[model samples]
Target: MIMAWWQILLLTCLAFWMIIDQITVGILCNYPLLIGFVAGIIMNDVKTGLVVGATLQLMVLGVGTYGGASMPDFMTGAIVGTAYAVMTGKGGDFAIGLAVPVGLLMVQLDVLARFLNVFLLHRVDHFIKLNDTKQAARNVVYGVFPWGLSRAIPVFIMLIVGEKFIRQVLAVTPQWLTTGLKVSGGILPIVGIAILLRYLPTKRFITFLIVGFIAAAYLKIPMLGVALLGFAMAIFYYQKTIKSSEDHESNSTVNNANGKEYENDKGEYEN
Candidate 1:
């Protein structure tokens, strides 16, 4: 399964599925973590897959698309990253270095894909105007082709380029640059987190942030434990807030009833 055509085909199909799934079924197949896990399974290196995939996941933590905007193609990048990380055995750092640029490059391809979709939409409109339902439906379905191919073609080409090409590139790359890439890879998550915090209600939830930090740093709690702790805190706050709202509402209702029964200045009941 490692670096073979079938593996390449599977990875390419996964890339195709990632985009289409995002637009359609949305089973979270577009996430880097899942992409890496699947890529790792195909490459027979689940541990490496998780590491590389998780790293990429961190890199896109706060990244999202609004309106018609497209972000980096980290999902496809995860597929390449995991596959190459497994094949090269050069560690996740080196794989991270390779994966990121591919993501950036995909921004342009994403635009191209969107443009192609626009063209197809026009074709669909043309058919619709002519009252050709089948042609219009066919053109509508044809929109899948651009998006699917956008990721699939690059992934197939990258995978089929073989391990030899990657090794050869690595052989010529400077040691300092390679080390830098490793360091940069580790720092990427911090950048993502910084971006996320900037957009979040950090001041209001600063208590939770400090608690999470203490749990991870001082308590040395595992991520799952910290996550569970967060869940517990969320539930407590949610219930407390809901109860406060309900109590306020009840008090208001009682006040309104008393007001309704009270005598006005004219000695008449007023609502």
Candidate 2:
């Protein structure tokens, strides 16, 4: 299936915008859901785009590029995968299979972009030492190119070449492998959660975690309700901890004052 030239241009623009957005604006446009939605609009298949976007979003729910660490790039996946699915008349499962691997492969591209940014940083540093403020600012702005290209180049190539390549793969790939990819897509979200748990104060927050899980799993509470419950619990915990600390401080102050008074009386009596 031949994607229109305009469609290719639009997707590439989005890919570039999302990467720059992650770096500068941080308005979360780089997320899979938004990418998929826009991609769907471009591809004239909104429903399929939404489905692919949401699925990819879940797979990378807790994963982030924290501290410049590499994570799977669901944004790229959303664009390419959704396009592939819509073009090929494949469903969300097929899209997920295609997207997950694309996301994983893009991690290397992310690292390369970051490595290139180091040179820009050094240039900025040199300008700073020379006391050339304008050049320093210019160098900082120039840094956007490396990042934009890192995402945009691959997206362009994929949009042009991926449809045929994916069709070929699907044609030759065994049923078992296709099924496995779908299953792996479903399981991939757990990895994001596990990574998140590693950074969380699990023991400290375990009670809340369990409560949220139970509310959702057993009580059949909707996610919004569960989130509200969590919000209320957070406020209660904050107040309780603050009150406890204040009371302890007050008691310590009273005890110290009483001890000083007793010492003075004993000294006066001795004199």
Candidate 3:
């Protein structure tokens, strides 16, 4: 499963693009599914790419690098994992298992990139104080290098040398550990869901959750059907709540106006 030089170059470029897109453009090119698909195209294996990408996507869904917090780098995982999977003829499960550790390892790289960007920020600030507008703008553009290299260097190394490392590790690793890794991969997505639930109004949405679970578990409804049901419920709730609030406000306004008019009439009669 030797990767051609062009394939390695393409992957390196994808890695660079992912970080730059996240830090500057924010076009969601860093997302796992997209990364996987592009890697798949580069490797001439779209199906494997989709499977690997979707698996990583599910695992990291709803987990974000909000407030400068570091999370697993699923984008790198997807690109590397999909390439490895396609090259080695390993199934999606192995790719998924590989992704967890790869993503976790990438967290350090992400932090390093951010830390380096701080220096760039300082340089930009210095230029601003000197009133060098052109230099300040150039400094901002220069920040992209650290971020891009942080991702690209690791990806290039992995694509170039990772196959032999993976094969060697797989040969010596126990079967039980391998199975556990696969199981852990399957379970990791629940952590993402739990993180999402922490921010939700769980008590208010508990009933809907129960209904959805039942629909999926017992009634065997497809995910699309469940999603549509949820959408309908949201629309219904929004309309009902809005109408009730509007009616209450309208009634209050009318009653206040009528009471004022009655008071004026009574005062005139008394006078």
Candidate 4:
């Protein structure tokens, strides 16, 4: 796969998932499904890719990163796991199972990335204090670009160099170790979720989490499908809420104006 230009390009793209994941804040742009889908496309296994993407997406659906804290590393797991699955003609579940520990390790990588960012943050602050706008911009580059490249470049090199070695390793590993890795992988994300829930609005939102799980686990709703449904519901709820608020504001303005006008009329008559 690495021999072909297109394959290399796609794989390079797969590595950039880290950069994109770093930059984007929303659920839409995050790692899991996007990486899986990309690998699937590269391998001509779109269904498996999409399925893997969606499954991993659901597993981490309730998880979020707040204030640069560690969360499961979905990018490594999604891209690498999907690539392995595609190359080996394995199922999406295998990709998901394998991705778990990789995802957890990724959290540490993210923490390292954040630590690197502290230097940049300090430089940016220094620039602000010095009132050196141009110097600040330069400092921002010094801080951000290297970190972004650091995230992408090594993974690209390693994925290319280590692809074959990984396959061999996977083949010889015992069932117990593989099972342990997968089980540990699956369980590790729960800690990420717990971390996320700590910063979430409240326990009330937990019900929505359960409902979403049932939808995926039993009803077999794809990750994309569930995400779209949730989006539509949120949009509907937002519009309704906003409209009601606007209506109340308008009504309050009218009432206040009428009261002012009536008071003015009484004063004029007395004058």
Best by TM-score: 1
Q: Estimate each model's TM-score.
A: 0.93, 0.79, 0.87, 0.63
Give the runs in model 4 whose Cα sits over 4 Å from its true position: 1-6, 17-28, 179-271
Q: lDDT of candidate 3?
A: 0.85
| TM-score of candidate 1 on Cα atoms, chains taken together | 0.93
- Model 3, residue 204: C-alpha shift (Å): 0.8
Q: What RMSD value applies to candidate 3?
A: 2.5
List the RMSD of every prediction in angstroms. Answer: 2.3, 3.4, 2.5, 6.1
lDDT of 2 by residue, 1-271 (tens): 6689899999999888898997787875657998899899999999989988987887666665679799888989999888888878767877888898888888999899999999999999999999999999999999899888988998898888756786887899999988887787667666667767887788898999999999999999998999899999999999999999999999999999999999999999999
Q: Taking the tens digit of each residue's C-alpha lDDT, what string does model 3 give over 195-238?
A: 77887897888988898889889999998999998898889889
Alpha carbon lDDT at 5, candidate 4: 56
Candidate 2: deviation at residue 73, Å?
2.5
State the lDDT of candidate 1 residue by residue for 9-100, as single tens digits: 89999999999999899986558998898888888889998998898988888677987898998888899988888888889988898899
Best prediction by lDDT: 1
Worst 10 residues of 4 by lDDT: 19-28
Model 1 lDDT, residue 135, Cα: 98
Between candidates 2 and 3, name the one with more favorable lDDT. Answer: 2
